[model samples]
Target chain A: MAQASGKSAGKSFFGKFGVHIAVLIFVVIWTIPTLGILVSSLRDKDQIIASGWWNSFSSSTQTEAGRLPGPEAQVEKDGRFVIEGNIFGDGPARTISAFGVRSATPTQFQAGQAADLGDGVTLQLNPDGTFVLSSPVAIEGRGQRVYYASSAPPRFTTENYETVLFSEGIGRSFINSLTVTVPATIIPIMIAAFAAYALAWMRFPGRALIIATIIGLLVVPLQMTLIPLLQLYNGVALFFGVPSKTYLGIWLAHTGFGLPFAIYLLRSYMAGLPKELMESARIDGASDFEIFLKIVLPLSFPVLASFAIFQFLWVWNDLLVAIVFLGSGSDQLVLTGKLNALLGSRGGDWEILTTSAFVTIIVPLIVFFSLQRYFVRGLLAGSVKGG
Target chain B: MADLTLRQIKKAYGAINILHGIDLDIQSGEFVVFVGPSGCGKSTLLRTIAGLEEITSGELKIAGELVNDVPPSKRGIAMVFQSYALYPHMTVYDNMAFGMKIARENKAEIDRRVKQAADILQLTKYLDRLPKAMSGGQRQRVAIGRAIVRNPRVFLFDEPLSNLDAALRVATRIEIAKLKESMPNTTMIYVTHDQVEAMTLADRIVVLKDGRVEQVGTPMELYHHPGNLFVAQFIGSPAMNIVPATVEKTGASTTISITGGRKAEVPVATPADAAGAAISFGVRPEDLRIATGDSVLFEGRIDYIEQLGEVQLVYLDIGRPDTPLVVKLPGNSELKRDQLLKVDADPATLHIFNAKGRSFARDHAPALAA
Candidate 1:
C-alpha cells in the first residue's frame, strides 16, 4: 500500500494534468497552420478567398451587387405596374439578409422590408434573391440595381488540386524533388556511417583532430561556403567540359553540406555503444570492417534512421541550395523552387498556393511519421543500458 | 590446447601506466585467475593476453608462438567481457555463431558447433530469443557459449560474473566452473576482484597491487603462506587482522611483543638484523578461538557479536579501540558485551611480517618438523 501511495504521489497534479496540457499546447501550435492549409486546399476556388478556412464548413456572408431582370422578362403582378424577377437569375441560390439601392449603403435595409425610391416607387428584396419593384406608373425598360449581403452555402472541391498539379508544374517538380532528396539523403548517410565508424572505433593518427574538425565544420554557415563551393564546382565542371548545373551537382552539393552534421550525430551515438562489444567482436575473429558492417551498423539503425529523416526533410524543403545548384528548367526544378515560382506568378490565386503548399509538406509528413519511432528511440538510446 | 606466457608486458597510455611489466607462465589446461583490488590492472592484464590491447614493451606467446603483433582473432583467443557483450540486435543462436560465420566456416559445421555449445549451457530453449529477452544468468551463459563456439586454444574472462546479483552470481560461477571442467584442454585465464571467485575457480591465483603482481600460488598457499601483508589482507573474507608489534627476540623462532606488553612466539624465522624492529602480526579471523588453558595469546573484552547461521563473528577489543580483532566462533557460543575474553590461535596459523610489511620466510616446515 505504501508503494502504491508513493506511485500515486509521483503521478501528482503536475505529472497528470500539466504534462498533458503542455503536450496539447504543442500540438495546437504545430498542427493549426498545417490544418488551415489542408482545409483551404480542398475548398472551391472562389470560396477560398470568400472566407477564412475556419468558416469553410459554414455559409459565409459576402456583399454582392446584382441587377434585376430587364422589364421584358418582368411581369405585371398587381393593379399598379409591378416588375418582378430574381436578382440571381440562373446562378446558384444565395440568402440575402439586407439590401440597398446605392453602393454607399449596401446593407441599408433589411431583407423583406420595403424601401421608397423617393417618387412613389418601392423595392422589396426577399431572402432568396427575389425582388419586387413597383411604381404608380409603368416601370421603365431598365430594372433597378440593388446591393445585398448574401450568404452562400459551403462549397468544397478537388478541382484546385487538379488544376495546380496538372497545369502548375508541381507534379514534375515533385518527381524532381524525389530524385534530389533520395540521393542527397542516402549519399550523406552512407559516407557518414563509414566515416563515423572509422572515427569512433578505429585507432589511427589524427582521429581526434578529424573529429574536432567535423564539429567545427558543423558551425560554419552554409551561406559562407555556398558561393565558394559553387565556384569550385564550376571550375571543375569547366575543366571536365560538362554542364555546371546538373542533378548530380546538386546531389553532391547537398551531400557536402550535410556530411558534417550527419557524421557528428552518427559518431556520437556510435561512440556511445558499449566498447566491450567492439572488443569482444575483435577477439571473436572479426576484422574492423566486418565488425563495423555486422555489429556496429545493425546496432546503429536508430541513429541512421533519424539522420535519414533529418537529411530527407532538409533536402526536400530546401530552396536556396536547389536554386544555387540546379537549373531553372521545368524538368530540373525541385518542389520548393517550383513553389516559389508559383508564389510570384499566381500571387492572387489562393487555391493554387494552398494546394501547392500542402503538396510540398505532405511528403515530409509521411517521412517523419514513418521514421519518428526510430527518431525518438535514437534520442533516448544513450540513457538506456542493454544486457 | 595451448600454453600462454607473458614476459614483461607493459601497457601505458601516454605515460599513464596501467600495467607494469607483468610476467606469467600459464600452463596448458590450467585455470589461472588474476585477483586484486580495483585499479590493480587485472582486467588490463586479461585484455593484453586476449590481444584486445597492445603491450608497450614485452612479448606475449600462446602455445610457443609469439603473438605480440597478432590480431586478437589470429592469436586463437576468445574473451568473455564483463558486460557479457552479446550483440543486442542478434538472437542467442546468431550471437554464438557470429565468429564462425565471420571465419567463413561451412554451414553444417557452424550449426553443429552452435547447437552443441547451446546444449552444453542449457540454452537450447532460449536460442531464438534476443539477449534482452533473457535473464542476467541466461545472458551470461550466452556470452560463454559465444566463446566456446570459437573453439579457442586460450579462453579469457574479464570479470564475467561481476554483473549478476548475489544469487545469480553463485549460479553462474558454478556454470563457468563446469564449463572449464568440460573443456579441460583449453587454457583459461579469468580476472575478478572478488577473491571468492578466484579462490573457488582458480587452479592458481595471481594477486596484484598497483599494476604489479604481488604473489602467484594456489588458493591454500596464498591463504597459509601470504607473501606480504597486502596478499594476506586481500585473499580471505573478513580480511586477516594485522596489529603493530616489536620484535624483541630474533632467532629460528621470533618472539614479538604487542602494544599491551603481551608477547607471543611465532614459528617463522626472522632475519638476524631484525632485532628491536617493529613488525606486523597477522592472523585470520576463522583461525582464532577462545583459549581454555595457558596457551592464550591475548586477552580482551567482547565488543560485538554477529550470529550467522552456522558461525558467529565475535569482535574482541584487545585494549585497542580503533582496531578490534575479529574471531569466528560457533553460533551457539555464550558471549556477551564487555565480557573479558582470552583468545588464542595455533602457532602454525600465526603470520609474522617485518617492518616493511613483507612476510618472514618460513624455515619451520610443519610437515618436516613432525
Candidate 2:
C-alpha cells in the first residue's frame, strides 16, 4: 500500500505540471534562437539587410531597381531619343518609393513621374519594365541605367555553402583536422592503456606515490605549460637542425597535454577490476606482462575507448593550444586554427563561417559515435565470488 | 609424483604476522585441502605452496628440493584460480597452449598436449571459442585443462568452483575428484571454506584459524575426533551443541553432569587428576535423540523448529541463549516448536574439552583442576 501511494505520488508530482512546465521552458529557451539563426542563414542578404530574419516567413515588401532601355529604343515620338520601360515585370508590383540614375542619389526621383534633368530632357520608368526618355542630346554609349524603388519577395540561397567550401578553403581544413585528430586520439590511448595497467596492477616501490602525483598533475592546466613546453621543443629542434614549427611539434604537444588525464582515468577503471582475476592469471603461470596484455587490456578496452573519444574531440576542436604551440604557416595550420582565421577575414560572409564551423565539428561527431559502443557498464563478467 | 613438505613455514607482513610456524608433510599423490574461515590464510598458504607468495621464514620443498627462492613458473606447480582467469582474448585452444607457446615449445608438442588436456576436460568441442563465450562450468574446466597441460608434479586449486552455481559447483567438483583419482601420482593442494567440498574431495583436511593450523586429519577422522573446540564447531553444519559440564567421576569413561541436573558418560578415559573438575561436553545435532531415561543430557522445551527436506532441527533452549543445544530428527518425525522434550546422545558420540578449547582424547584425559 505504501509503495502504491508512493508511486502515485511520484507519478502525480511528475504529471502535476512540473515536467510539462520544465519542458515548455526548455523548448522556449532553445528553439527561438536556433530558429532565428536558421532563418538568418537562409534569407537573402539583401532581405536581411532591409529587414530582420524574423520577417522572413511572410512575403516581404522590398525596394529593388533595374536599368531602363538605352537611347536606341527611344524613337522620335517628340523628336528626342526616347527611352522607356517598366522596372517591375510579370507580377503585381509593390509601391515604387523612389528611383535615381546614380547609386549615391538613389532617391532622386519619385515613382510614376518624370524627373527634370535641366536640359529640357525628361526620363520616366514605370513599375513595369518600360520607360520613356526624351533627350535632346543623342543618348549614345550606355545610357543612364535607371535605378527604381521596388519590392522583392523573400528568398534564400545555397550559394553561401558553395562559396565557403570551394572558395574559402574550409574543405581542405576539414581534411587536415581529421588527419590531426585520428592520430592524436589513437597514440595517447595506446600509450596510456599500457601505463594504466602497470600502475594499477604491477606492484613495485613508489607506485602509490606515482599515482598520487599523477592525479595531482591533473589540475595543472595545459595553458600554463604551453610556452615552456614549446620552448623546450624549439631548443631540441635547434640542436637537431630541424624546423621549430612542424606538425611533429603540435602532435607531440597535444599528446603530452592529454596523457595525464587519460592515464588517471584508465588507471582508476583498471584498479577496480577484481583482484582474483589477476591472481588467477599469476597461478596460470602468466607473467606480469602476459596478465596485463591478456586480461587487463581486454577488460579495460571500454575505458580506453572512452578516453580516446574525449581526447579526440578535445584535440580536434582545440584552437588555443594549436595556435600557441604550432606554426600558423599555411602548410602546418590545423583545421581549428584555420577556421579561426577564416572567421576573422570573412566575418561578413555568414556562409563561410557556418560551413567552416560545421566542417570542423564533423570528424568529432563521427569519432564519438563510432567508438561509443565500447563504453559498456558490466564488462567485468561477475567473475568474483558474489560479484 | 612428489612429496610436499613445509618446514616451520611462517608468513608475516611487517610486524603483523599472518601464518606462524606452520609445519606439515604430505606423501606423494595425496589430495590435501586447506579449509578455514575468512582471513584464516588458507588461500595464502596455498599461494605460498604454489610459490605465488614468498615464504617468510621457512624452507618449502617438493621431494626434498628447497624452492624458497624460486619463482612461481620455476616451482613446477600448476594452479587453478577461483575465478578461472582464462585469457579472454584467446580461444580455449590457444589459452591452454599459451604457456608452452611462451616457453617456445615446438608446435607439434604444444598441439598434442593442449589436445590431450582438452580431451580430458571435455572441452574438445569448444576449443575454438573464447572464454566469454563459454559458461561458468566450461570456463572452470578450461582453467583446469590449462593446468593439466603443464604436466607439473603438483596441482594447486584455489577454490576453483566457488564461482559456479550450485548445480555447476557439484558437477565440476565431481570432475575434479575424478581428475585427482585418474592422476593419482600427482600431489594436489586444494583450498576452500565449504565444509562439504573439503569433506568430499580431501584425502586429508588441514583446518586453520587465524593463520594457525587447528587440526589436520582425514575427513571421517576429523568428523569423529576433532582436536579442539574450534575444529569441532567449524567442521560441521548446524554446528555441534556445547554444554558446560562438571566432571563428577574418574574412571575408564569420564562421567560429567550436564545442565538440567543430569549426567553423561562420554567415552574419554579419565585420569586420577580429573576428579571434580569443569569441562565442556559436545554433541552433534544428528547424534542426539529424544531420551526416555533419567540421565538425559538436556531436558528442555523446543524453542524453534527448522525443517529440511529429509531432516529437522529442534532447537532446545536450556536457557543458554548464545549457544542453545539442538537435536536433529528425521523430517517426517512428529516434532513442533514449544514442545517440552528430553534429548540425549550415545556416550561414544560425545566430546570432552577443557577450558582452553582443546579436545581430550578418548584414551587419555588431563590431570585434575586444583
Candidate 3:
C-alpha cells in the first residue's frame, strides 16, 4: 500500500509539473506580442522604424548621405581652401561611426579619420558629426557628398499615444465603443438574467420549450443571420421613423447576437442551484421576483460576471456588427472600426498602428483582470454541489 | 393557534406516486415528528404541509383555512431544510430579516424580531457572519432563526439535524428541544429517519412506512405497544426478536409453542379463531434476562457477545442457528461463549402477533380511550 501510494505521488508530481509547464508556455506565447505592441507604441516614431522593438532599449544605427554646404562657403587658409561644417547640421545629435565618400562603401573609413581624396583634398569626420574638407587651391563649385553611418541613442516617448488619441480619431471611437459595448453587454445580461431565472425555477407551460429553443439558437451562426437581422432592423427603423445607423442600433444588434448564449449559460447555472434554497425562500414569504432579485441573483454573481466579461470582450472587439449596423462616420465608429481604419491609413506607421491596437485592447485587459477571479469560478460552479 | 389537518393527502409525479394517502391531525403547539425509513415519503409529507409541494388530491387546512392552492408564504408556515438552506450570501442578520423585509414590515419591528430570534438561537454573536462562515450546528441555528423571524404559525423541519456530525447532532437536538420548550404555542412538524431524534424530541411520534402512517403515539406507547411488525422492528434498536411459534391456546392469556418445542404464555388476549394458528412471539432484547428459577423462556448456547460499556448483547443459539436470539445482559456478568444458558422474560412483556403481523395486545388503544 505504501509503495502504491508512493507511485501515485510520483505520478501526481509529474502531472502537476506538466500542467505548470503548459501554463507557462501559454503565458509566454500570449504575452510576447502584447508586450511588443506596448513597447513599440511607447517608442519615438522615428526609432520605431529604425529597429525592431526587441532592440528598442539600445541605440539604432542607419547610414545616410548628406551634402556639405555648396562650395560657396569655402575659405582660404594657409594656401588651402577649406570647407568646414557639421555633417548633422544642428539636427538631433548622433555619433558618427564611420564615413565614406560613396554609398557603396559608406563605412569604409572609421570615425575621426581623414581619407585621402588623391587631389590634395582630404575630408575628415569626427564622432560628433563635425567634418572638414580641404583643398590645396581654390575649391570647386559643388560641395562634397559624404556618406556616413550615425547611431542615435535609444528614445522612448508617449508621443504615439498622444497623436493617436488626439488626432487619429481613436479617442472619439473609444467613447463610441464604450457607448455601444457597455449597454450591449449590460442589456443582454439583464434581459437574459430575467429570462434565465424564469426558465430555470418558475414552472410555466413553455419553460422547457423556450430553454430548448434558446439552446438550439446557440448553433445558428450569427454570420448567417446578420444580413436578415440588419434588414429587419432597417424595416423597424423605417416604420418608427428613426435613423438606421446609430449607436443604439449597434447596441441592440450586439445584444441580440449575444442573448442566446447568455440565456443558455445563465439558465444552466441558475438551474443547478439547490432547489431547497428556492423552497426556503418561498416559505419565507418571497414572491418569484423577490426570490430572483434577492437570492438567485446574488448567488448567480460568478456566472453573471463571467458572462459580462465574455460579452464585453466580444462586443468591444467586434468590427462586423459595428460596421453593418452603425455608419462609418466618426460618431458611430467603434474602437475595432477605428483600429481597422488606422491599420489601412497608417499601415507604414508602426507607432500609430501599435498604439491604436494597444488602446483597443486596454479596456478588455482591465475588465478581464478585475473580474477574472470569477471567470474560472463561474465555469466550475455547477460541476460540484454547494461549491 | 395553528393546527394542521391533512386529509387523504396524495402526492404523485405523473404516474409515480410518492405519497399514497396520508391523514394526520396535529394540534396547536404540538411538537410532532414523522419518523420513517428512507423512501417512505416522510419529507414529502412535511413539504406538502409547508405548501411547498401541491397535494395531488386532498384538503390541507392550516389554522382552520384550506391552503391547498395557497402559496407557501401565505400558508403561515416556514421550513428549515436538511441543508440549512440559509441564503449563502446573506449575513445571518440579513438572512433572518429577508422575509420580513419582503413582507415590508417596519424597519424597527423587523429589527426587533430579528434580534429577538438571534438572541433565542444564541446567534447574536454570529449575526454578521455569513452561513458559510459558521459551523454546521451554527448554520442550523441560523436557519431556525430565519424561520423564527417569519413568525410562522407552523414550523416545518425536514431532517434539520441530519447534516450535522454525531456530537453536534446531539447538541443541536437538545437545542431544538429547548427551543420547543420556549415557544410552547407554535406547531412544529419535524421529519427524520433517525428514530433516536424522533424518540427524544417528539411530543407525539408519527411512524410512517410506504407513504402511510404506521402508528401515532407517545414514545413510550410506541415502544411498549407497536401496532404492526414494521413499527415493532423499526422503533427500537437491535430490533425486537421474533420467533415463529404455533398457538396452542387462545384466551385472555394465550400460550404459544415455539419452534424449539418450548411453550411460553403471553399476557395478550386473542380471538377464539386464533387457536392453533401460526404466530410470531416477540421479546425485546433488553427484556430478556438469565433465568434463575424453574420458569425459563429458552434454553440455548451462547454463540457470541458484544460488550458495550454498560451492557452486553449475547447471541444465543436455541436450536435455531439461522435465527439466533439476542439477549441484552449486564456487561459485568461472568459469561463464556459456547456455554449453556437459560433466559426468561416476563409474561406481560411478551408479544404475540397473528399471522397477518397485527399485534394482539388489547391495551394498545388505551391512550385513545382517554
RMSD in Å for all candidates: 3.8, 6.2, 2.3
Worst lDDT 10-window in candidate 1 chain A: A378-387
Off by over 4 Å in 1: A1-19, A63-150, A376-387, B246-259, B269-277, B363-370
Chain B TM-score per candidate, please: 0.97, 0.96, 0.97
Q: How would you encode candidate 2's per-residue C-alpha lDDT over B9-59 as one tens digit per residue? A: 999988988899888998899999999999999998998998777899988
Clashing pairs in 3: none
Residue-level error in angstroms, candidate 1, position A286: 1.6
Per-prediction DockQ: 0.73, 0.38, 0.86
Query: Looking at candidate 1, what TM-score does chain B attain?
Result: 0.97
Worst 10 residues of 2 chain B by lDDT: B361-370
Using TM-score as the yardstick, the better of models 2 and 3 is 3
Report how far off residue B340 is in candidate 3 (Å): 2.2
lDDT of 3: 0.90
Q: Give fnat for candidate 2.
A: 0.45
lDDT of 3 at B332: 95
Predicted candidate 1 versus true structure: per-residue lDDT over B242-282, tens digit per residue? 98899989999999998787899998888789998998999
Per-residue lDDT tens digits of candidate 3, residues A106-194? 99999999998878889999999888888897877788888999999998898888999999999999999999999999999999999
Off by over 4 Å in 3: A1-7, A75-79, B364-370
> B1-370, model 3: which lDDT tens digit per residue?
5998989999998999999888889999999999999999999899888888889998999988999999999988888999998889999999999888888999999999999999898889998998888899999999999888888898899999989999999999999999999889999999999999999999899999988999999888888888888888999888999999999988888889998999998877888999999998889999999999999999999999999979999999988768899999999988999999999998867888889998986654464344
Please give the ranking of all candidate structures by lDDT, highest first, separated by commas: 1, 3, 2
Pairs clashing within candidate 1:
none
